[model samples]
Target: MAFPRVSILPLLLLLLITPFSSSLSLSDTITKDSLYQLCSQPTIRKHFCIIWLTNDPTTFTLNFYGLLGLVIQKTQLYGYKNLAMMKSLVRTTTDPMLKIPYGSCVTYYESAIKSMEEAIKFAILKKYELTSEAAGKAFSSINSCEADLAGRNTVPSDVPLRNIRFKRMCNIVRVFSDVLTAKNY
Candidate 1:
């Protein structure tokens, strides 16, 4: 039997477009469960990660890099908050002992904020190692601040809580960056 002739162009176009379209849709369909799975990776606090990421509506639309960027942004904001708190402590406290540690915290948080900004830039560029390094630096800064406050007998209760939360955010960035690096994405 003879077959009717059909153009191969349409078949070629479909073949070329299938993979790209499917991948695009896969990325676009990111949901809360997928985010939870990502956040539930070992060494990450699943609950904390989920709550923070889901708090912003835009997070549902982000891929891995975008999610990491959001975490870095949150870390930067927390750094600024800590800086403001330290500044307030330094200004309002009459005790020289309190002033010494709070003053140091002010400097540390300033450095942390700078590091977070660097992390954000590196994350955007998909330089996962650099992003992790920047986040680690920010984490170290928070640790230093905590240590300084530890020696003081009159440290404010809220200061410690803020430091803990800020450190957690930095950890999330570091872990997520490491995952991206490992995947070589």
Candidate 2:
């Protein structure tokens, strides 16, 4: 009984100290729980969701610095259905103009454009106030992705799987960028 009491004391102390060790900072985006409470207010919920949604895209930029690990975590939470579709399209396409095993790298590019367009629309409608320049920036990301696709496709060799993956990852980083920069979100 004495030994068990001593052991429990140490365990309890460890648990208490573990939580207090973390530092709080404002650069941190507001928490989901708090955001949810804000959302319940009716007037602010849409803006709240949109703001969080928009913040997701700017995550991939060269300048991205805030809460890097958390940003990735949120993007994962969003679950890239579009990105997965784009990846599958790129992986399967064999022709550039028509359909073969896939359409080569262009398939991914097309999917990206489609996805960004939808994301912009999402921002403009529910959280229009949350997005940068009111979805204008998100719109521009589509064009930038297009330009990037053109460059990658032109550059050179047959689109390897690695190349496809790299384009898929790097270009979508802009999604987070547009979101974060968007004034409303």
User: Model 2, which residues run further than 4 Å from truth?
Assistant: 1-33, 36-69, 72-84, 90-139, 142-185
TM-score of every candidate relative to the true structure: 0.82, 0.24
lDDT of 2 by residue, 1-185 (tens): 35534557887676556532132222455455333332233222345344653466543232222432333334333324434544566555554632332343344445444544544554435343332232233334334444445534433243343343333332333333343344223
**Could you tell me how far off, in angstroms, the CA of residue 15 lies in candidate 1 after the best superposition?**
28
Mind sharing the TM-score for model 2?
0.24
Runs in model 1 deviating more than 4 A are 1-29
lDDT (Cα, tens digit) per residue for candidate 1, span 14-132 = 85565422323223435886677667667788898898888989888886667777788888987898899899999999788788888899999999999999998898898999999
lDDT (Cα) of model 1: 0.83
Query: Candidate 2 overall Cα lDDT vs. reference?
Result: 0.39
Q: How many residue pairs clash in each candidate?
A: 0, 18
Residue 108 of candidate 1: its Cα lDDT? 93
The C-alpha RMSD of each candidate to the native structure, in angstroms, is: 9.0, 14.2
Score residue 13 of candidate 2 by CA lDDT.
Answer: 77
